[model samples]
Target chain A: MQVTRRQLLQAGLLATAGLVIPALGRTADNSKENLLLSSVTDKDDKNWWVLSDSQGNILAQHLLPGRGHGSARHPSGKSAVIVGRRPATFMSVVEVSPQGEYKFTDLTSATGRHFFGHAVYSVDGKFIYTTENDFDNGRGVIVVRDISNDYKVIAEWESGGIGPHELRMMPDGHTLVIANGGILTRPDQPREKLNLDTMKPNLAYLDTRTGEMLSKHELPDHQLSIRHIDVADTGRVWIGCQYEGMALDPMPLVYHHDLNQGGLQAAEASMDTWRALKHYTGSVVADNQQGIIGISSPRGDRVTFWDNQSGKHLQDIKLRDVCGLIPSPNGKQFVATTGKGDIAIIDAQTLAVTSESRTPELHWDNHLQVLA
Target chain B: MRNCLLILILLCSTFSHAAEREPEAYLKMLNQALKLIQPAHQLFADQAEELHNQIGQLCQSPSEDSLQTTRNQWRKTMESWMKVSVIQFGPLLENDSRLRIQAWPIRARLLTMGIKQLETAEAPPTLEQIAQGTVAVQGLPALEALLFRTDALSGLQQGQACAAAQTIAEHLIVLANTLNQRWQNEFGRDFADPVNTPGGFDTPQEAFDEYMNGLVTAVQQIKRRKLEDPLGLAGKPGKAGATESYLSENSRDNLHNNLTALILYLTGGEGYGVDDDLIAQDPDSIAVLVLDDRIKGITKYNKQLTMPLEALVKPATPEAEAQREVAESIFKELSLLNKAFENQIFEALGVTRDFNSEDGD
Candidate 1:
């Protein structure tokens, strides 16, 4: 086959990325036990919050009140909530009974505030903390909802930055770590980042009980918009960044921080690999089983895994329209979903794709929440 | 044509077997794209080359008859362009090539400045230089202005504007030839068998997605931009100037060519309609049949239209009402096609137009 100059250049870049990220070593976890949850866009332009087994079989699905984004589940695993995507004014809270019956409720955000498409239930399952855009103030805030009292907005707390996205409780169970994305945007423009030059993204730790600011760690580069995150049991916060800088300027995409150590460490991938990541990561999964951090880039159509200890790129899997990622219930595998409807589980250690399925006629959106 | 009738019968009878016939349907799509759609682009290049030659002939001897013949040639070339216009990816996507060929609405200020500069400059810009100039006087739209202007023949007789017209024509041929050559020899051939190449496009499914999406968006443009906007569905009446090709009064033909090319892609050109093959074994071939009728409806309306699209919105004549009816029908047909793809063809085939422009934040 003849190789044109453009083709050769592309091959060179991929080959360079391959040098640091190894071909996935094969290992299989025959587990189909974990239930995965996601917001899906179906063929008929309808949106649904969907739950499936690790094998991607639909277990339960419900029509969302509106278009949805990342979901939050109560620690008990019996209930979950789907937050409407940015600028959407609603949230759906759903509970699945042991008998498989479902109960649902709709909660509205306060005036001038909109859910930023992600919410996390308190570890005790009492309150759900959602990342929201305080559009009037152009700041990110965590809106606390009392699940016991009809999921009402009980309290609000500053996220310590402008655009707080995905947040998770610390391993200690008392502190919540937030990825305050630092970019400012309004509901009118929706996802447009109004402030970039002065944007200050940080990984912030807050006292869950008092809403007191604990510590905030910012990356060396201001242009890197720290957004999505997943927490390991060891308290290392793995972050995925969406760059708000120039498209041509290459920047680090994956990061991890030890709140104890007090600094953000960039997951070291080759420049070629980082470029292939397209300066965007839609989601991140931290596997406790093997300390693997999985980050998905939908634009690049790639899921890259890295070692948490060394911050080294372990392996990279090529997928078309890949975005969602989560560690399976067993933590031994990562269930990855794509906008093209692929649901594949990669073994955390070997990075081998153990099983795969395609949900015909469905487009899985940016985040997948798994109950291990 | 006989084969089409046979396929139509086959499609209607066993429509529920889409799952079983899905692979064959996709393969046929690949084959038809390579065979029928690829040639449409080559024909566009060939016609563009002819137009360049005709413009040169008109410049050599300015006459009313020759100018009229040249205008006819322009219409034919544009129709050819619309026929192959759905191939928006691969070779056609490079270097502002598509926009250079046809920038709509004509940026009046830049065009006036460009023409003024051309007239006043002692050394007029050459074909290559004009190719590098602004889009206003760069391609077909520029040629339209140069030819259709009321003062065209007078300016041609004075040996001014003729060189620029001929130069724009040659530049268009260059772009068209480049696109045609690249598609026919390299990109089109490689894209047909994407799995064979190791650099990217991980699966055969991705190649299918690319082809179908190209056609899908082309159809979308025809419905949303070409027809609705001019017909005052997108805008209020008397705003047909938002219509494409308005200067030459060919917006209806532009739309007709668009739908004609879209139908050509839909059916694979005298072959089984993609919906027919993909939905052949599915229960929803009923939607496909309606879609088929709607396409025929568009063709019928095009045949019956008595005036250009510009008149459809202005003065609100009875014929304008007729045009409005055709526009509404075309809109419904486009919706049916979209639904058929979403519910039956694309779903049964397990492909997703995931990166489609319609997705929200």
Candidate 2:
């Protein structure tokens, strides 16, 4: 029987109402290196689109719950899991055929609540890690699921932090990292309750298998929120925040971390500290290959480029409400999206807009995925 | 197998189609609501600003006469705001997105208070009025804050909220226990006489109705008492109001009971047998499904739902407003569904069955 993703979820729910118990396959961990790269609409409206790269062309489509706010390719490059946008729910598997057909299997709903940013597939491709908002209870839970059986949940963990939004599996393979957004809201009426009492963003590291919180590095209390994050191949994690509402007191914050004797210590700010950056960061991608890291703030209408080697702001591109940004597989082009749903392709080297496409049907084209 | 697959495809398609259509429908509904309220909001904002300035001036002068003048103006201004702001919840209830309706009571209360506070020396509001407004504004947000505190306290295990949520959970437990005792001591009858619903006994609607009304009243009283104490243990150092810590504790204690009362009543006498009629089947499942569908449906039915709310709240976009509307509608429907579900559950226990039937009638 070809069980649909929703059915799998329903069946799983029936098995256990309170806890999500996953269905495990016998050979679930067997290595399958065929990764699919196809752009399935995480959300639709043509102008605002999140694309997945196949060879050189971008396949454009919208997902039902909407486009992914974040996506991570499986190392084998055959499949990828995406963290789709709000009222946060599921992590969908974007399966690519050799022919490049996109089939999405609902992997797991956000146990923590709504998912915001990227979902990273383990380097071994055995598991997928993602972050989510636990709105019902007013916190965040970090969920890890096994993709072996089409997609079934394996284990789940909590961030021990409030509002864990984005996640990336560090290149170290053992460490699963998360951005613990420090915003507190009433569990039920999130809109009304914005209590900043115990608010403090943290970069949390956890064990992939045990779901044990290994280490937590907290940021200054003043940094509004640590939301989206990217981990470099060299094991450096770059973090970003969506400063507390439009009043510029809390501009977007970015910092790199180093594990030291006192624990994870924040490295000195690499570039001119961004003091006036407004609702600026939704996407952060650190390019290990190109030696540059990119941070895009669609609300700020700018994408700041940083020279990873020198730790400097190379340039900034203004794309209003820029939602997604990812390097092409060949490392020659950078693909990005705007809230208005425009796809701006820029040269990897010059970082200049080479071409732009619009998806009129797309409303909130959020994150991008690239299958190598 | 092929037929099964076909049915599966049909179900999936139906759901997706429903999903798409639901948001649009919600948008339409909201747009209409926005049209009805936009003029009023603008007027409310203007008048509110002016009254606020006047109140500020009165606060500076500090006299009974100035206070009386400010108070009188506040009352007049408040009356105007209410006239302009009172949402016809009937339309929201009837619309695809019922969740949006849930916030109306709360938001209405806040706006009312915003206008009320303007009268620097108006006659003190009756305890009943204060209690009602405070409960309305504080209900969901307070519960949520407690939940978040639970996570912090419980150490992020879904169970963490249990400790703080315990206070609320305990209250729920007490309500369930009391209702059980009432049935045993007085009625000594099965929750329902039994008509044909899935579960044999039903929470006699009368009993369930009384239970809910009394519960709201009792809740209001507690809130009033809470006002007297203000902070209790969680009181702030200098602030007269409750401290976050104390409020968290209070919410924790109270929320559990509320939820338990809700859950038990929703379950239809399966847990304690207070009223079989309250819940017929698994109230939780039914409530969740209904809430899910309503939320989804409201989003689809946006045209009717979004306009009025947009006009009222003045959110950034039609879609964002629609999202909020659907969420509200889901929660509101869930509250009603939850009550019904509890009635189903309690009815099975054959206790306090007829207590509330007349009230609804």
Candidate 3:
């Protein structure tokens, strides 16, 4: 019998209350339960992939060869892949068993390409698509890898712009929406931006089956590098930008693109709110059940929430160096992680911290993923 | 169960004891820093007002002496700004006031466009009109362009250009005055009494972290943006125009004032400071020792930079190459200072450096 997340949450609560249910314990294996996954750097500067429970307790951890960025969970719910940060050459695949044991397989980047720190698995979990940099050619490409064949490259296609950072498969499973960050960099220079004066960032929707570009929508300002995105259930694409212009210039850091409307609209916020974000948004996530979208500004040390339907600013919560954000397993709360080694569970409706924990030894990275 | 409870109580008391002592030290340091900061802002406002008065005289009399007087006042006002620009928190960051006061490494094209628009307007632009205009036109850079540039110096004599200069000076007075008043009033009181006002920090450690982060960022801006990028010490091609205060030829003086202010902040002028607290915590702290050494290194090299930074970067001249070497030495010392803060000082203080502040996407 398959157990749902709601059932597990209920069981965990009952156990916490000291109520003994013999049959429930036999059926629900506590060791197999996982809540969230993130890449963490310890005080020693070593990197690890950490899986934790809802209460922020570490369930399992595996060391990575290098620092990892965003992660993709397999549809089977038994495995996940961690990609290295920009100009990265390694990727690690982690498989977990029902007994809570973990296995790891590492993959190397193809010649003349490096991972841009994000990837998404196909709906069937048969293939993974990664955003990569064709640095020598000064272009971005999406490489399709077959999961069953040692994660080998099956095909490749243009990412519709220069520096694609993150991509997600739409609900339909065949459409991939990509955030082309639009800042060019060569491998020799690595993190230095090569094209700030003329960077044109865009949101591109591609037909995965035929490798054809469906539509591409560019931001109004060429200096706003579209870096991260999330798709709401209502078919709206939420974008987070890192501005490359003068720090004093006022620019909206969050935008949304509606598939039906076919253009990008800035999320409405006051000028002070825009300044408070400090011109960089590290992550964007949508809580469909709560009808709210969240954007984390690590530079501002705050997380801002917006109403998904209207694209209007709702509220702001102060969390020092917060960047990683995701919906809770029950879909009623936001599980946020901070670079200062904090994890907070925020009630979606009230926007208050219901619970929080700190691990002083570990610094969480930019993006968080549900373990599935 | 009784023994376990006893042990827990003992642990709690020990943790509480350390936590209680830290806040007191932080408050002392904060109070000293504010003493320096509050007065600096007032001087900045006063300097701006004097600059405005001098510009008015230049417009009415149209003499070179008055023009030179206004230019000298502008430099004094810019120095005041550089001293306090190291402050990266509180009212300075509240409404983009810092940018309105001085936007540096300015876009020449944008500044030209803004001045042209201001000069060619049908009527004299009001303070409200200038305030609502682009930040490029409303602050010190605009005033600098109007007062110092060869083509714009003529505008100080008469016509719409004189009107634009007077209007921008007026805007600077307002911006400077607002900053001064805010620091002297609620913000200053709240900073001094963090426990009662909370001042957006739950504990004194958080406030200290913010203060340290500001100092770290100031050092970074000095090294990377002000020196290395313009001087080509960081592997990028050198560009003289990239230097801050390039047109005013006050770039070296800007560095001197910034370093002096940083030293005041770290040593707390005449009162208790981070150095005192660190020594009290550990008499033989390595962080404090290394920090003082780096500070000495910066001062030594900074004094050696006799020429303006723009002239130092010009290639193929022996004197320019010699000056570049001096600038490079200062950059190296700054790099070490930044590392001491990130690695040693923060670690000694048990402050967790946030990853995003250090490395962001």
Candidate 4:
């Protein structure tokens, strides 16, 4: 890695940030560092997609006109496409160079539809598949964009449920798995669930190349709205749920289903812990190397770990208002963020905090998209 | 060196001023716990203790006068419990103490089973045994059944039921004292993290989030569970006993107290008033003030529901329909308040909703 004059100046300004903070200028020399990407809000309450180095040093920040949710890092390792918060119309394709220079191109959802705040870039870096709403039709959709040609909308398909949220590509690289959270919301009435009486949340799988629906699974209890998800190297989908039923009812918040197994397996936990969760699980990620999964519950104020194969409750580490969770680039640890801007790196084996960092001023939002 | 560099980066890139506003809010939270929540719990404990003594005297020599006095004290104690119940976020949640005191959406099976055991058992339940008893007989609802139910109260007036009633009150007093102690000694300190290190709160934003989340959840619970559920506003047939405090018929007053606190807390009357600051921070502060007004409006509407919630929900008369209208108003206001909470409060505090928080979902 070459350190140019530009790099030295950038580091100086970053280190000697006076009361009047300077804009973080990108260095001309490319430095190979593991950068972590996530959506953030600044002191003025504006939203941004921020990139931080492996040690949690701020690198680059790109402002979004609206709030952002989950982001999709392109396979080419060159850029990321971050979608705006739901009922969201904007998606910003952010370019991150090895030299720490960050740029972005903004795109809008089709009329009468919007990004559900999650998308997946093609493994070959040719296209982007975004979860969207066909709001007028009362169905969800998957819109394919040709990345080479300005993210042009090339194709569309039903998302197989009402409100499709987080989606990821399967290990096969062509099969896209989606969590279709079956709550209807129109732009006019943003974030309002119109159909709790008849919500039909499901875990859906589709072939990315053809938009062909291969499989879809719904919870037996319809009130458990399937939302955020993470797919492992082995294609096991760990799903999280937010229950719309009675608050105190005991409901399973974590589930896993292997694509080949064709059956959804519920993670087993004591009724006490499940009750403590209050029918809410925020983010779900699989620590593939450690053979475990971690789920966060901001409502319960705890992050719980579960064994991947046995679906057994492994451990619970408590934190207030914590949500964003990402397994480390190595898969040997997990980095978790909260609504209060606290970050903790947990040892995957012991489920213990290795180190904790706090950004008392900024609230780290939902998903942390790790970039290598 | 690594820690130093980390601290330098955190200090340089992050804005510390945003954290400064937190102490005011943090102090406000401590004020609420001390001024409102602690005193409310203490009053409930005192009332429960007084009720126990009254029940003891009544049972020692049963009379219409003595028993009526005991029944009246029971009503006072139950209402006092409801006032303290709104502090549902912290220590009250520990050991399922809240449920132990008064489990609502009340279940009759536990009451029936506990009642039969209390009346027919060879030995009257010791406090330890009653403490160990299923949650059903351990709370105010059991007292409601024992006092209001004919066969059950007969056992109590006959001196067969004095011990269980006495035990429940003693247990409630013990819980109240523990709650006050925990809030004072530990949980309240934990709630108001003055320095962010050892304080359960890592930062002021966290303390704010916890406080707002608890308050919003309480308001929603009152609007949906306490009022709308019994009113059958969601189109289900409302049941009579399903209303909170159904036996005592004070669910409306419970709503009033809840709405008052919700309004008071948000308006900066109690402490950590986010509304005034929210309004001042943005030209669009009207939205937040309007939300506060809506919350206050809930208290007014609560007063208009002169009929018991159980009665209002059971019959479809004009008066019942009017009460349902009040319920709907409260529901809509609470819904807007919830949204304002996520949007206004989040913006004022410079925070974002964590992934998949029920707010955005």
Candidate 5:
């Protein structure tokens, strides 16, 4: 493709300065005309906080645990799962009230000494699974517990990868998508060396019923580790990678899976395929309809747009280590939560941040979840 | 038409292909380095983990003797990793100009080394180890080639702390040289158009240069406006109420404007996004928007433009003789940033513990 002056200008700016400030005037056009995105702040909220559009005035919100990024809600929306990290990696199972208040009726996995609490509910909401790193041996495990009634320690599944970072419910009801990061680390220590030599990302589908490892796939050796996963509505998987290189280079990459093939396929087919595949990946998610996958790297400060079908690069936008990305309630917009803690909304079509909301408590705002 | 396009492409390609013989030597050297350094990075990481575990265990123990013993062991482990990482990765940048620019694995190794020391140190060491480690730790930053625009000095200090706690400012100047060389090399490849390069960049090179330049310039300004000089009102204006202070807020703001100009010029006037309107604001007026809570010196202010800042650090003791100490501290920080920046750039090119950036495709 012939390079346009605009493309050249943009590319030049991105390479030199490492930043892109969009036109600020776009924020005036309200995304949700009925519900003002302005009042979407979590005000001195104490016990329960949810992003709610309950009155149809805004999107959905819920009161999750104080450290919200570590938890995931079930696809069914019947129960909200929250992981608390202090004292230990603790999970609180709460019954969600219509008013967005969570009744704290249950807590699980509190006995462990150091729990780096990363948990997700099964598609059916019958089980709650989380990764717990044993501080003693530097080993990690995927604790599959029974939350059928409140929460209980049903079974524990060991993460095949050294540090299993996050999990998602694969479209096929039987499999749980797990990102087994190959970095061996103690709970207190930031991930030690990424086992680069024999490092293989354990992209596996564990049978939730038996807590047995069914199908597992690994990444190439040089890739430091795989940490995040987003399963599309169609059962395809988008995985985000981190800690591949230092801050200078691109933040590794975002990979997609052939729902049928069991391993990661090229996120985009053309253009130096392998080289592009290894950039540091971050949070990966499919939109509400699961048509497009959104991948952001705060380190790379860019979010790539991939065509869900052919896996072509439709476009990419310059943003920071966008640690967290979520589709708007309606899926017309993408809400990107940066590592610096600025929340921005990008139009699904234009792929531009239409609005931004910066909250005071934005330190390392890693993930964003829409409470039903 | 196809032949003509091909000829045009070939002619364009030749000028841009600076070191293009399949990148064989560079790739081979990188692969060899990865084979060696990947193990080293991992070993250091593993050792750091072990030390952290031991420290954790020691902290749990009620006995002071046990704690002291554990601290010693931890220090030993840290010293070992720091030495191996520097030795293994530092030489590559020193030896090869191309590697200096493209070798990310070496840089990744260095970052891991710094991270290993910082993370494993957990808390500041005992005064004795702190003293010893200061000498050892301070040198790591000087070895780093890539310097981050933000927190470069802090990163250097982090390296400095690991060295033995005693400041090593002189080594930092050397580090700055390495960083400048690496940046020039990488920037030349990543950004410069034929006209810009006096040599040309490949499509990928051109694209990457633009991308990095824009991204970096934006980040600098973002940090400047939001994190650094909010409005610039820092540093006393030079003169009395003659009219404007010697370093009037306007001048300080102007300094920020100048820093942006510097970044734009350095990056080929392509990457920066600060519009002309913002650039046009008086330097002193811009200087009035300074913020305190953020790190100082991250954005510079001067008579003309906001200078690109080094990492902001705690102000030193106030005394006339302290001038030497301040200069030493500045030198130390610059060295550390240079080393760290080089490491970051190397890693960005795809070189890491096990993977060389050049090996990707």
Candidate 6:
């Protein structure tokens, strides 16, 4: 008999409650037990925030009113929050109880603002910071929410640029690094970029405690929209950029900024390698343990790896529409998800696919998260 | 649940069949497309050279006959470009060839500023200078403003304006020849054997997907940029000024050529083409039927328009109103054509519609 998603989720809940249902055919691999979370559009055209084991088994899910983009897992591993895609008006928080039950709370965007599809939890998990577009004012803002007070908005700070995207906290736990994309857009126009010629993208380091801008770095070319980022434990930040200029213009799509170095430097790659990326980098992730950085270009249908220490190109693996990437729990491998419904684990040292599975029913979105 | 299982089984069968189809079939289609495309590029180059020569003649000795001949040659060159613009891959995508040949939705303000600078310059800009300038003033749209805009005839009769037009015409010849040479040489060979050649596709399916994507994007450009934006069918008041080829009054002809080129691409000029592949997958495929009917419907409505697109969009009289109606009908048919490709053709052919191209962060 075929198992339904509802039944599988129920089995997961029961297992979490210390009751095993052997008839449900749970795989016997407790060593690889972390749950991967992603926003997906299913075959039936429904949006969902899903949690699945490394083997691609759906464990829990919550239907979303709209498409979701990035997700953040709470430090305690008991909850995760998913933000709707850009020009977003809703965010969903899903909490899993020890009894295997799921509680979902939906939050609306603050007035005159829209979520930029990414958010981060504080090191203590007491607050959540989200990037938003203050459309009427033509500025990007960071909204701080008190996770303990029912996710209430407590403060807002300037993001120091126009179209700020992904943000991450530095290892110091007091600084927030933001990728200001620099393309001016309004809620009325939605995805239509209003400014490209005069846009100035920057990498900003902000003191989260006082809402002060610490330092900001900008690229010489104004059209490179720095969109996504990943920070290693050692405080090296990797950024992925999407170029808004002509397609024929050869521009590097990945860059790194070291807190100690104090400048934005392009990742060293041959011009041929840069051309193959099709001028778009959807996601950037780093494995500090192995000193490797991986940047994915869904437009180019490949994921390229680089030496984190030297910023030199290493190798690329071809995977159609592969975007979401994260370091595995052990930091010895990388877990990747694609829009084609593929989940793959690549050995960090050899860059070999250790395991892969395809669901065909779920089209994973841009970002992925792992529940600790 | 039972119905879902049945659907899954059917999809798996279709997918396996698509995978098992010989790569030779797709290669044959690619070769056939090249056959049509190579000569189209050659013709465009030939026409550009002729336009260049005619402009030089008119500039050397200004007259109504010479100017008219030069304008006529420009029209021929533009028509030739429309035929091959559907092939947006390979050499056309390399080195800014497409933009250098014909950058459209022309930045009118920038073009005017560039022209003014050219008019006051001490010497006429050379071909290299034109090539090095901004894309807005380097190609056919710029030439159109120089040769067809108000007072253009007087402007081009022995001054810096005529010299600027001449240099731009020369630049077009160089751009067109480079595109044709690259397409005929290495890129052509690599494209033919996509699975084996370096810098080529990884699979025959990928090559086929590229071809289909080119065709689909062309149709979408025609519908959205050519029609909807100018006609205000996309939820704003119609702007006659936004119509492409407004100065030349050739917008309707450009649309007609675009549709003709799309149909030719689908049929592969009477050879094995996408249409054949669709029928081979399933004889009663709805995608093929919709595609054929919509093309015919669009062609019929386009042919019924008695006025240019700019005038039809403004609709000043009863006759213009009828023409506007015909234009709207064409937009509807183009919409249906785009839908068929997006919904059915990609799935039936086992081609994955690119996610990032459609929606990306």
> Which is the leading candidate under DockQ?
3
Q: Residue A76 in model 4: shift from native, Å?
A: 2.4
| Cα TM-score per model | 0.63, 0.45, 0.89, 0.74, 0.47, 0.78
Query: Residue B123 in model 1: shift from native, Å?
Result: 7.5
**Backbone Cα, N, C clashes tallied per candidate:** 8, 135, 0, 1, 114, 0
Question: What is the alpha-carbon lDDT for the whole of candidate 3?
Answer: 0.81
Q: Tell me, what's the RMSD of every candidate?
A: 12.0, 21.3, 7.7, 8.6, 21.7, 6.7
- The digit string of per-residue lDDT tens for model 5 on B1-361 reads 8567645643443222122222232333322323333344345445444544544443344245644454454344334333232321122223232122222223334444643564356565443442233222233232221122133334434432333222222232233344444334553333323223433333333233333333333333333332233222233221111111111112223233333433332222332222221222322221111211011333222222222122121223344224323323333333333332223322222211111111110
Expressed as tens digits, the lDDT of each residue in B85-116 for candidate 4 is: 76657777766678778766655665777777
Residues B1-361, candidate 6, lDDT per residue (tens digit)? 8567645654544433123457877788888888888899899989999999999998888887887888898899999999988886667766667767877765567777778788778899988888877777788988888888777778886458988998999899999999888778777666777777776676666677677777777888899888998998967778787788888898988888888888888888788887787787676666566666786897688678668889976789999888888999989998988876755666666665555545788
Q: What is the lDDT of residue B84 in candidate 3?
A: 84
Give per-residue lDDT, candidate 2, residue A112: 44
Candidate ordering by DockQ (highest first): 3, 6, 4, 1, 5, 2
Better of 2 and 3 by TM-score: 3
Model 1: how far residue A63 lies from native, Å: 4.8
DockQ list for all candidates: 0.09, 0.01, 0.34, 0.19, 0.03, 0.19
Q: What does candidate 1's lDDT look like per residue over B1-361, in tens digits?
A: 8568746764554333223233455666776768886688889999999999999999888899899889889988889988867775555545556667886544456666677667566765698787656666777877877777777778665535788788889999998998888778767666666666553444556667767766776667676667665666744453666677776887778777787777777677767656566456554455455556666776776666556767766647776777667667777677667656654556455466754123423
Chain B TM-score by candidate, in order shown? 0.85, 0.23, 0.91, 0.84, 0.25, 0.92
- Every candidate's fraction of true contacts kept comes to 0.16, 0.00, 0.59, 0.18, 0.02, 0.24
In terms of lDDT, the best-performing candidate is: 3
Write model 5 residue lDDT over A33-72, tens digit each, in one string: 3221111112122223233221122122233444444557
> If you score just chain A, what TM-score does every candidate get?
0.88, 0.76, 0.89, 0.90, 0.74, 0.91
Please, what is the whole-model Cα lDDT of each candidate in the order they appear? 0.73, 0.45, 0.81, 0.73, 0.44, 0.80
Share of the reference A-B contacts seen in candidate 2: 0.00
lDDT for B194 (candidate 5) = 27
DockQ score of candidate 5? 0.03
DockQ, structure candidate 6: 0.19
Clashing pairs in 3: none
On lDDT, the stronger of 2 and 6 is 6
| lDDT string, candidate 2, A83-107, tens digits | 6554446556656566545565664
